[model samples]
Target: MQFIGPDLKGASPMNPTYIEQLFVKYAKINTRSDPARSATPTTPGQTELAQLIATDLKTLGMSDVQLNPANGYVTARLPSNTARKVSAIGFIAHLDTADFNAENIQPIVHPNYDGQDIRLPGATISVAQFPIFKTLKGQRLITSDGTTLLGVDDKAGIAEIMGAMQYLLAHPEIQHGDVAIGFGPDEEIGKGAKQFDAEQFHTAFAYTLDNGRPGDIEFETFNAAQATITIDGTAVHPGNAYHTLVNAIGIAQQLLNHFPENDVPEQSQNHEGFFLINQISGTVAHAEIDVIIRDFDDAKFEQRKQWLIETIATMNQQLDQPRIQYTLHDQYHNIGTAIATIPEIRELPLKVYRDMGLTPNIVPFRGGTDGNFITQKGIPTPNLFNGGGNYHGPYEFITVEEMVTAAEVVARMIIAHGA
Candidate 1:
């Protein structure tokens, strides 16, 4: 079941090519989730996209299609046509784009590149910044024009999932058991599974098609948490400010100085943990700093948070005035611990990829995903690839061949689970 061409009328817009068609539809919609907002979905655009996807699911003739407004999670059921003894499985993808630059993304569809530095109007998608760009020498690559992200991170996942479902529906002869579909909002900000209703989904296992690079099927991610350091400062007249004023910015900087400079993200990779300061702002009267701690090991992750607490306490001792306060809030944790108990669930993606003539790269995610949250919920969920690269940046790309292949993997996984 191959994607012969673009299903233009069936999709939002008529894409000239299959990859172009998918990118056009997703890029046109603005689905950036706001982290600062207290809303469930975090952005209204996500709900709009959820409604649209629910309608698409209905048109595909899937059953129990419902777009719950509580958290804007779209869920659908595909009852088994065969009497195979298999667990019901689910396919999940997020609807919201990352809070990064995503304005008016113009995707460049180049068919069979000659392996040179592909140049956009304003910038170059060079092989230097991304050496893997050389790996895709002759593949048809779809990339942004160096301004906004391609949104291939999860939209590519959505398109691939939809394409595979369409294939399965068309080919009734393909034996399979119950299949579930789920799409969420605010995944980029770590709240995608916060309000996800597992009961409504009713799946024994699931997979999140959200990863960079093809053939990447992950079962582990970093345990994550955020901490805030607030400082109070007294401002006095310059003439009398010498010894009476407590500069909040200076205190905040001193607290950050406690962490090892080499452990930052720029210098860390491949399972190494780090403490990152995501936001910082201060005035003479007050200051606030937001810190994120990430690690795959629970013990180390805890130690990282404790280090922040101890650093703040140590900083407090240096100041004669009580001008600082700190708070550490746990955000999400690694799914490996939970999934370890469900080893059978972890082997599904690997088997699917192997059956598809692709070797599964079983790697640990330095970041996190909705899969982590679902794993903690007692339903083992891993992640699959959506044929994307350079995520959360303007140079993000997904190949047409890769997208079609990913869809085929989804269909194969469903069929295997049913078998």
Candidate 2:
């Protein structure tokens, strides 16, 4: 299988002219995911971005370029260009940003960054707060204007994958196997991968370009779930209120009290488990509370989920009828357990980094990723870097150097495996 592609001049991993263009083009779209929405994508922008990327994949001469409107996942395949019996591999990235204001996202480019305080219209990237900037001196930096999020969390990953695909397509001299890649929505809220069709996405193993830093690799992620509790009460006039009158709002407050104050999301950090009451709604007659649970340890994660169920049960016993009912949905578990089975998937990226004169930095992510669900399915899916920092906020930024480096890592992994 052969196709003609343009000779991309000055487009190596070190020189990221092609990748930077793709980053800027993707970073401008407003694809902020909504957890509240019941749809798979939860936002129209995600599907729009998927459509654009799908078109680009077709233009790049990829096969099976399908944009699934049902789940907002764009899947494509680049058949093996070599006859060396190379095993097919997969790569994935999300299309949506975090839950923040994402309207008219105008990216600001910093050429030859001076490593100083970067003041934006809505926020400032302080050096004292983020010392990582000091190390990246004289590089091309991309940031938000401060009013809205930069949307670089997964967009950078998307750009890296697309850029690498373009680079691979052009330079057919770099022999590789069949490459399968996908882009989906609602990763921030942790619902995107729930609808992924792993059986359909055939691959021997996969990698997710969702991590941060140049050499970042993550096999362990937070064991995650969400709980929604609803309360029903009898509202009566204050003047005529008696033992018969039950206040649902007061019961909602009591449920909040049952959670540990110090173990909430705001107070917790790396490796610590927490129960977060993300959304609360109440009235005298009806009330509801939404909570998300997280822990890296499997046993401890179960304990957290059990505690919620037991607390709700105890509260129900005190009521005349079981007025409190809740639903718990497990989002994803740690990929470490799954990735451990296939050692090659984990070692491939590390070898690539070491060969590139970079050290492999293994991180236990505090949050979940699309890889969690995919890894749990069957094929081992480890995570690689997206080359960005300060994710899910206004201070978010991505560097052209690291973005291209990440793409190179992806390409090299294929060459190493295929060879």
Candidate 3:
């Protein structure tokens, strides 16, 4: 099981070092996505990582290796050695980290971790705060040095997919159909697979390695939409301000006050939906409020959008002018609606997990993933775990053994498909 890499002297695909090295190397690269930018990747660091992954894919003897700068997607293909006409399978992970502190990430590896409080420079992962650490006892855990995020949200996923591919390449006797790999950028900002060429991806179906914990297989996600409300105001001299002047900033605050504070991200969990005002900025002359709405049920999602429109109309009527201009558009729909027709896509992972002696935990993904967009484009893509905990922040951590297990599960899926 511990076969050394031909190029990476001491690295073995089965050994946790192989995936840990890749994770540590990738986590150091600051690929944090910016939502304010309108470009495909929204940042240059993503392109840098994409290029690095492309070179690594070629080094792994993968074919059709391509790094599309226009979209910031790095993809490659591993041809099948079997004669059976099995449909090609795809595995996807994002290149960019979340919008947290991603600069100067110092990944610290704790080998043979005992159940103890891990102290970082600015943050601490206390056993009391995260009881799950007790379960990960005796495993090698990787975390940030506390000045920045660990970037294991999707970097772990990338390393797991790469490890699985390397394992199959080293063991040619394990039969599998064509395996396609895609590393997308800006998934943190929900634009990772927006420009993904599914036809060119050449896969009948896919799975996004972008969730938390092992044995998690999620197909249900929130129906999402984004709304931008622009408020215009009249500016006048102080002498005439009493009757002629209007403050857009004040109106923006008033509009926000109308939204129920209890119906926000912090107050809602599980299947409950919420309307969150993520960003708001402006002066007296012009103001803008950027909000996001999420709900799992189609009826509730539509009602939320309708409520926003009605709130804007009510504000305009009170102001006696069209000062508040707004636009609400669908970002992505729930993937469960599309995947419901294809039972095999969901059942495959369950069967794989059972065969691997792992309990399959079918949970509703509280947020969205690349699978949401790709599944809408004719692929029944679900989400698998990246074997991490406390994602998207400084307290994020993952065990080397968990990542190795993820790679083994991925390899098992491919082998099962070829059967």
Candidate 4:
């Protein structure tokens, strides 16, 4: 019952080394997306990663491998090898890394971990900062050398999907329905799934391999939105007088004070909503403050949005003129609403973990994923684990063995559904 690869008897085992090699190759690529850019892929490296994945899928005996230039999405299909009629499903992953220093990424390998502080060139992966290192004491861990992010937030996911497809193709003995694969760009910047075509993916449901460990299933994510407040100040000579000049920076500070001090990312936990100030910049003439709002409950999410609108109105009343302007846009919503239509999709992973004799770690995802937006597009997509830890930072790490487990879970999920 230790389903290391395909759950079926006599099924071929997943190549852990193969998955590791692919991960290392993809990780070395600097696919960091730029939020400053409005382009679809955001960066050139993301389009490059998408192209590479399309070629890999084609070489792995996949059909209909198409790379859409408009949005940087690489989608393919593994035609059904069985006669049974079943719905097609998919596995998706993003190609870009988070916003961090991603140049010259050197993935260091600790073949034998000793449970000590890992000193690198720019930083240290210590047990104190990340106590989870103790649980992964002796595993073969891969990490960045402190100068850059390891890109494991999603590249590990790409490798797992590739490894799973390679295994299914090499064997051919396992009967299954059509299996779809999607690799998109700029997910780190929260813009990847915006242009995804659910009809083109042609899947009844899909799983996005994001940042998490094996045996973990995430069906719920935060209802997310972005808010920006722009203040226009009447810049006058400081010597001329304080009464005529309105300091925009001072108004920005006053606006920030209106936000709940306790309701922030660092203070919030499971199911707790937060208001994160993503960016704030400007001079006395003009200033802007960007915030991100997230909540699990729809009512609370709406209320949070209403609070921002009301706060802006009340603060503008005190001013001589209405110089404060704002813009509010939804980023994504919780996947719970979409998946509720297909309750079985959420339960399948639990059964897969039980059948594999692994404990199920079902929890509410504190952040949003590509699945949140993809689900809103009609397909019930939930998040699967990529077997990595401490994502989006220098201390990020993942074990090769866990990568194999992630690949195995992909294969098992496919068979459990359509085989």
lDDT of each: 0.80, 0.85, 0.88, 0.87
Worst 10 residues of 3 by lDDT: 1-10
Worst 10 residues of 4 by lDDT: 1-10
TM-score of 1: 0.86
Task: State the TM-score for model 2.
Answer: 0.86
State the lDDT of candidate 1 residue by residue for 1-419, as single tens digits: 22333442232211225434755677657788898998978888888788888888898888899998898899988889887677798899999898677766777888997778888875788788788888887878888888888788788888888877877777777788898989899999888798888887888888899966668877789888988888999888768987888788888878778779898999988889998889999998899998888998899988888877777777778789667898888887888877788666777777877766787788988888888887777677888889868888788888877787788788877876777
Cα lDDT of candidate 4 equals 0.87
Q: Which scores greater on TM-score, model 2 or model 3?
A: 3
- Residue range with the least summed lDDT across 10 consecutive positions in model 2: 1-10
**Candidate closest to the true structure, highest TM-score:** 4
Clashing pairs in 2: none
TM-score of 4: 0.90
Indicate whether candidate 1 or candidate 2 has the larger lDDT: 2
Better lDDT candidate (1, 3)? 3
Tens digits of per-residue lDDT, candidate 2, 33-63, equal 8878898789888888898888888988888
Candidate 3 lDDT over residue span 342-416, tens digit each = 777887788878876789888889888999889888887889999978988999999998998899778878888
* Residue pairs in candidate 3 whose N, alpha carbon or C atoms collide under 3 angstroms: none
Which candidate ranks first by lDDT, i.e. highest? 3
